[model samples]
Target: AERVWYPLWDAGLKLGHQVGTVAQLLDVGAENLETATSLLAARVVAASSADGEALVDDLAERALAQWKGRSRQNLDQLQGAVAERHARFGEVAFLLEPDIKEARGGLRDVHSLFWVEQATVPILREAESAGLAAAFEMLLEVRVELHRLTGQRADKLLLELQDDVAAALGLADADVLMAEVSAAGRTIAWTGEGAARRTLRASRRRGPMKALSGIRRREVAPGLVLDDGRLELTDDADLGDPLLVLRYAASAARHDAYLQRGSLERLADHAEPLPVPWPAEARGLFVDLLAAGPAAIPVIEDLDQVGLFVLLVPEWEPCRSRPQRNAYHRFTVDRHLMEAAAEASRLVGQVERPDLLLVGALFHDIGKGYPGDHTVVGVDLLTTIAARMGYEGDDVDLLVAMVEHHLLLPDVATRRDLDDNGTIRQVADAVGGTVLLGLLGALTEADSIATGPSAWSNWKAGLVRELVERTSHVLGGGDVGDVVGGSFPDAAQQALLDDGTFVVRGEGLELTVVAADRPGTFAKVAGVLALNGADVLGASAHSEHGRALSVFRVGSVLGGEPDWARIDEQVNRALAGRLAVAARLGDRSRTYRPIHLTARPARPTMTVDNVSSATATVLEVTCPDGVGVLYRITRAFAELDLDIVRAHVQTLGSDVIDAFYVRDQFGAKITDPEHLAEVELSVLRWVAVDF
Candidate 1:
């Protein structure tokens, strides 16, 4: 009874609508089992015919409800049935009726089908040329035969009706809408001229139609994309349909079977195309399949096709001339690619997807089997598989492009002599552009990791590091410098003690001393200060962080003629730029420990001039200066091998300084006054200056 209402509804709702576009709204049911089921198709009942404003508003309300599985006019299979109805009955008028599909599987809910059955009449209809009215009636009779005789009506009848529609248009069925219907569980083909093409006598499953095969999975590499075969695919390998079951079965079967040239030639001649009945004009491949075919490429899709043709044409298995000494290589060329693919699959952080990476890695080295660049060959393999897999055209191209630059990580990044970013960026730019540099970085790491521990070394790993860093810089841009700067901390300020040692400002600077740490190390250091008249405040010595660090914080004593300023300045200048010492000067500085400089009568006395101007003064006198005594005294002092601590001598208009500090027999300072006097008298007796 509901079947009585569909044509009426179609005529009422969309008879005058444009044929090229879907009406204002259409919804398909969401179901795991069936292909799209529920639907709501409508054109706006416009108040004033104002375009999408009215149309979209009408569609949105219904569509939102339909998407959420709440459309009142939803249909489980409206398109298939209505499409068939149109073909059988020609253009029938439809009326606005309650959605019968929402109630039952078929037009069986007759109680809800309370709508008038209206005949379709076009206001500006073209003339019926090839007995359109009679042909349509005949088509409906055939549909009834399938429903009554076979218990089902299928789309094949619609294909037959297409001929009649085209006949009305003065043409044979142009195959524009070829229909195949499954009736009584058998596929039937109908032509446009109200005729059947060929009865698919076998069930649709028995013919070339595919069985419901679940997608197959296989091991691939970290960054290399793999075909379902786990082979690292070349760019050409990114076939739209990787599972090209026929190709894979053939490819896999070849591995297990004996495929000689004679056999291959025979196989090529009979090799079937895509097992699925796809659109004839759909972007596809028809490989020569024969090794000796003159054509390298049967069909090309984007830049990736270059890669596919190469993999297809080559003999990929390796020979016996293997690298005997290498420990990691366990298989021939082809097997290695698969193994690398497996290794690459486990990696993350480097690629967008490990599976994609695995595919790429497998192809990266596969081309090495050929005569020229392996990258080129690998890319070709990728695109071929892409096409075979039925990937979108752009997707196929992207897959191949990845393969073309897979080897660049090693070939360009690592510099034996000098390293730079240009090569890294160039490789990355070629790869998934700047976006996938991180993935390339992961691929680079995987390449090294695949080489195994023994074979991969500092330089090799460094190449990986360079690629990682370059990618980071490119991706991070301005933020990379912040990463570098965060590693080292700023130097803490230190105080400059008058005792030529730096005192750390906040805490003592962890002194690192790499010099000879000897027995007199502490003593000798203390002695030098004592001799220089610097009183030590605090000192600590330790070894740490690959160097010996020593710190001494002391202040200048009243040493060297009580000239504190000169002493401190000289000490600072002496310590400044000393090889073993360095620190930042700050508010926390070292002060000299207090010590006195007392005048004592001795042979020679060392005095520090505190003032800016140079001045000389006598510190010790041997005996009294008498007539000619001064000359004798001076000569006596000179003869005694004594240096006048502050005697300024004018020699040929040049000032010669006779500076002194009295050193004993052991070259020590004469601090004792009595011993100093004895040493002074001895000097006087030697030159007859005084007693």
Candidate 2:
């Protein structure tokens, strides 16, 4: 094929005609056959005929006119078409691994914008077109390289292939490559959306009701006006005023209106820089903008796109479009920060200083764009950032503490034994007081919810809440033991224990098992729940005298409500040793093996912590999640003759971090080094079992 086309391509190039690859030719042919045919005819005639110059010009004009006519005819249907396209391939601009061809901000969107510009009057200005073209070329180059590397027709930039693609493009790493992709994709998507909106407005202005809709305007603030549903500066507005930008952004966000592209460009070109140690009014406006919640996202996005946001916060430049590169994060660093701030806005009523909360949430992950531990770096960054934003000493310190401890609550709640007194005291000491603790608590939730779905769950939230309550008690001058001790066997569970009878009850998604305190009690219940298709999200165990109480928070594998009756009956049989739980689980695993194990699983890890709790040994296990994982791990503990005091199970993406508070058969912490090694080995062996 190359031999046949090489001479023709050379002749066409010599004739001063542009040439593209076979794929480009196929794309043009697919989009419009007449245009493709006309271009081909023009190239062939110019290359083969002596009088082909004049004929080529006519064919080119014909193709241009055809495109212009099509654009004019389809102008009314453009918005719906864009929406349909977005519906098919999602509209998020910051997908960790994105499709370069068909995604919302991908090449297709750029094409749509090009078509829009070919209408009766161009929708995009010259500068906008040039920028969009550059972004389009960047994405196209990446897509081509991706196809070359994979040796297949590929578009989606998968995580596994990112590093190789980056190297092929002479980029530093996958993060750098993805950051470029993100920036380009965002440019295209933003421009395409603006063009579509302008097209709709232009079409409306030319309709029969044009006279009635003639440029409705309202002055919304000192220098800002709402013109035809868009926010823009008034003719007399002062661009020299440093506070104007913040006021404009805050007003646009609060009113939930679009920022006019012309106004945005003017501001980007002429707006003054905000003074360091911003004035109280400027700070207020910034907080008000963040207080707009989800509505602030698009407004801030527009500012970032126009290079206005970075001008306000110079430290924000590195974070723009920075990829998080993990399954746990749903957005880039900057976007996640904005989303976290937005989520925090909903809980403003819960915090003492909403301003501090809003600012803290926005800057919690700012240091992620830098080196070193994000928490430690974040503290140093916020110390200066907050001060520049007009915060006083106390406020600055509070914000710094917020950034430093943003992950503390969730980390402790999910991975540590919350019932441990040392755990509660450590959190209290770190938090310092109720005021800072409250800010961190709200920030933790907002940060987790913004991170991703798997980052926050009911079980995890419950644990954090329990931790916060215990920490708050200590900060409020109450005894730590009062909060952490002797509260498990509440009146109801104690009455069941007082009767000294085996009782198993299942209600909705909760299962409670009370029986004689034994080594295998927790393991037996976990196995029964797994066998019954109940996913154990969390569980806790407590024993008073010779009786034990085990409570499980569960969900069905197939979703909806759990079958409590069947689960209850199975628990009875398993606890009584009548059911073969292990054999049954093995058979189930063999019948319904996971299809997602194609990738090698991470090596399982076990950590024995005797320092966190004074009364029990804490075993933290990290491994890939599976159906019978909990059963296997707990079964190991039971076989080791360890008493299960409490268990905290948290599933993060494909992995689970399960922390167990265990004791020796004599109800003491396991302190022997050899015994600890044996415990770790047994758990690892059980976790690696196929069943």
Top-TM-score structure, candidate number: 2
Name the runs in model 1 displaced over 4 angstroms: 1-330, 348-350, 353-355, 380-385, 388-394, 410-435, 457-466, 476-480, 483-691
- C-alpha-based local distance difference test score of model 1: 0.34
Cα TM-score of candidate 2: 0.83
Worst 10 residues of 2 by lDDT: 593-602
Using all chains and alpha carbons, the TM-scores for the candidates as numbered come to: 0.27, 0.83
Tens-digit per-residue lDDT, 501-522, candidate 1: 3331212212212223222233
- Model 2 lDDT at residue 466: 90
Cα miss at 272, model 2 (Å)? 5.2
